[model samples]
Target: MKLREALALAIGGDLAHLAEVARQLSSLGVRVEPGGDVVWGPTRLLGKGNNGVVVFCRSRHGDIYACKIRRGDAQRPHLLDEARYLQIANGVGVGPRLYAYTRDVLVMEYVEGTPVADWWRAAGAEERARFVADLLRQARALDLAGISHGELSRPGKHVLVARGGRAVILDFESARPGAQNVTQAANLLRALGLTPPLEALRRYAERRDDLAFNELLSSLLGQLKR
Candidate 1:
């Protein structure tokens, strides 16, 4: 289907509103087929979630992108907010790169990989450890940057293990600036069934022992590397 038509169908209601949206999209250099056929550039539905529906779309240059579109009734702040957070993540070498976005649509580098749970099941011990390290690194980056990923506690569909052993974190609508954060590390420990670190961190906090905490984290990383 034409891009505009597919968008219209996905977000139904008034034709005029859809036209305006199409116009805005066109201004952003987006091209849509008028023909009701989606064959020119194939699209695959990536997912449909509370944030929006994600589809893998190919550009004329044959580059694939993950396009996230806002549902008609999706609440305030829109895709723009999500786009902003994604930009932040991009700066720190986390998440997919943001290609472009308007008020209701987001286009970004398409990350192809297996979901975390599936990957975990198939990964060897070394691979699992490395993946865990990467996950913690990313979480630490976010926390240090003052960005809180509210859903990391229940990660769910948010993390992907890309080809070549890369870990990509997706979805940022629930992210917000915060003073201190523990969602990422806590959730990761929960997944790994490691509870001692949480308590160790608490003890370090009480004693204000930065070196001890660093040593502890280093010890954990070393074990994972081995």
Candidate 2:
């Protein structure tokens, strides 16, 4: 389906309202990418959630982005808030790069990778170790930035393990202040069958300094080696 049609379906309104929406999108310099047909229902989409749906888009410059659009029934204009949190995460190197956003739309980097679940199972020991370490750094970054991902303990499909073993944490829609990112990530590590480095993690949580972080990394890496 066409981008306008798909967006109209996701966010139904009067004809005039829809036309205005199209104008806003056009002014933002984005449109559906050719040959990109990822879909869930009638709409060509990258992903969908309760608040919004994501579609693949191309800038006039032809760079691909994941455009998040607010669903019709969603609480209005949450993408702006999501974009802000994502920008904070981007500053700390924890989430996808946010490019631009309006009340109903968000444009951000498109991550091509496997969910951590599938990726972990296929990754070799060293790869798994590297993935864990990357996630730890990202988690620590969020912790230090004081933004909790809000669902990291039940990470679900939130962490994307891309090529070269970088683990990109996704969906800052639920991110909030007063983070416990490292603690939640340790819980995730436990769920993934690694022993949590409790004492080291606690020390890192208390200090959040380089020495504490290095000790925690060493502890986690030793578990992977065993």
Q: Please count the clashing residue pairs in each candidate, in the order shown.
A: 2, 0
**Residue 135 accuracy (lDDT) in model 1:** 74
Off by over 4 Å in 1: 1-9, 31-44, 179-182, 203-226
Question: lDDT scores for all predictions?
Answer: 0.65, 0.78
State the lDDT at 96 in candidate 2. Answer: 83
Per-residue lDDT of model 1, residues 4-117, tens digit only: 556566554476546755564555555442322123233335666664667665566666677776766566546787888888878877788998898877888778788777
Candidate 2 stretches with Cα past 4 Å from truth are 1-3, 12-20, 34-39, 200-212
How far out, in Å, is residue 141 in model 2? Answer: 1.1
Error of 2 at 17 (Å): 6.0
TM-score of each: 0.78, 0.86
lDDT of 2 by residue, 54-129 (tens): 7788899888898876766676545776788889999998788988887777888999888787777878889989
The deviation in Å at residue 49 for candidate 1 is 2.1
- Cα-based RMSD of the predictions, in order? 4.9, 2.5
Which residue pairs clash in candidate 1? 1-37, 1-38
| Model 2 clashes, total count | 0
